[model samples]
Target: MIRKNYNSLLITHILDGNFTYVKNGKHTTAHKGDTVILDCYNPHEYYTENGFESIWIHVSGSNSYELFEEIEKSNGTLIKCKDIHYVEKLLFRIYDSIKGDTPPSELRISVDIYKLFAELLNFQTTKSLGENNYEDTVQQIKEYISDHLSENLTVNELAMAAHMSASHFSRIFKQQTGFSPYDYVLIFRLNRAKFLLKNTDLSVSTVAYKTGFNSESNFIYFFTENVGISPGKFRKLKF
Candidate 1:
């Protein structure tokens, strides 16, 4: 059985015990360290077996559909352990932030959640294709991207990070990800922009600049093309 929460999507990191979920007429089971994606708009039910414990994040907003679509596109699903370590770390970070008595800001929390989801997507994509030395390469590339989202990222730089020639790295990356390196970067930037639009008071131009767009027009074009809405309209719809 599947239970639906119409107002919020649930990300549950099951620390222990058994879990099951059904989608598209199929059922899947998960053990400890697994994560589940419960789509609020979809009717579904799930339950824990013995010694069930998990951390759940409830996500809702006008941009929620966009987030869901991204996850779905990358084959994210319920009762999977893809990127469990990253999700587990994020859960702890969220807990720490709350327990540390820092004033809660919606934007900060939302950004963290988005990053967790993005990492999960990347993990799933990389895992399915079974690239050589995938784990280390992906981690290195992820760190490089995070550190330099404010700067221009080119295939040559990414190849250097992976210690491969530009052409070889591009081919291998596409083989592993089904997306070119640059396309992945653009998608990542767009995801960040979505978080900012929904969670921050920053102007669209400022958000674009902060997310590494060369200009507002470039940001708007890419965001609108990928996200199905202009940045200003997206912000207005969500905020």
Candidate 2:
């Protein structure tokens, strides 16, 4: 266990077991394959639990904090790695660069580190937003749909909200989320329908209308096509 403050951000990769952070009467756990961030301004207690091991890297320079600050403002948290293989490859690359012992200035290691951080931010944002690009727009769309799934949705209107051309939005949305805009809207409606069916006593026709389906037949057709069962059958199974 170690702690220090520098002009740059530090990243620690937990290779085995777990680590804990204690501050302000709260404990946060980072298990194996997890990564943690050490900010330059925050002082906190950290320790390994259950025989933990980790690799750490310190990055310091004039612009080091600047990059981290930008990432923090955009994404908030720095500890994210669900896959161990990805973390291992990143750590190996950083170690190899440090061990190469080439001219430090010639290596431009800080720039590489910033790029890695950017990639991590993008990955986390994409995973959370359900799309790789236009994350802010995607998040907005999700919120709007969640709040107003009963209202009719059009690709033109959604693209306008995203501030992009309809065709362009459609293409990029499918590329990022693996679903066309229409299909995603349908999926949202279907999911909400299931929730209402299971939890509420609304008639099938009412549920279909509230979920933006034009008719009970259309709702049943799509529900059966996508869910492999009619909404009535689904409700019965739940009951």
Model 1 vs truth, CA RMSD: 16.9
**lDDT (10s digit) by residue, model 2, range 66-141:** 6667666665433555465776776667777778767444355655676567665555644744443575576567
User: For residue 179, what is the lDDT in candidate 2?
Assistant: 83
Could you give candidate 1's per-residue lDDT for residues 6-73 as a string of tens digits? 77877778887866565553334556777777676677755433347778777777676677777766
Worst 10 residues of 1 by lDDT: 123-132
Model 1's TM-score against the true structure: 0.48
Top candidate when judged by lDDT against the true structure: 1
lDDT of 2 at 15: 82
Could you tell me which residue pairs clash in candidate 2?
none
Compared to the true structure, candidate 2 yields what TM-score?
0.48
Per-model TM-score versus the true fold: 0.48, 0.48
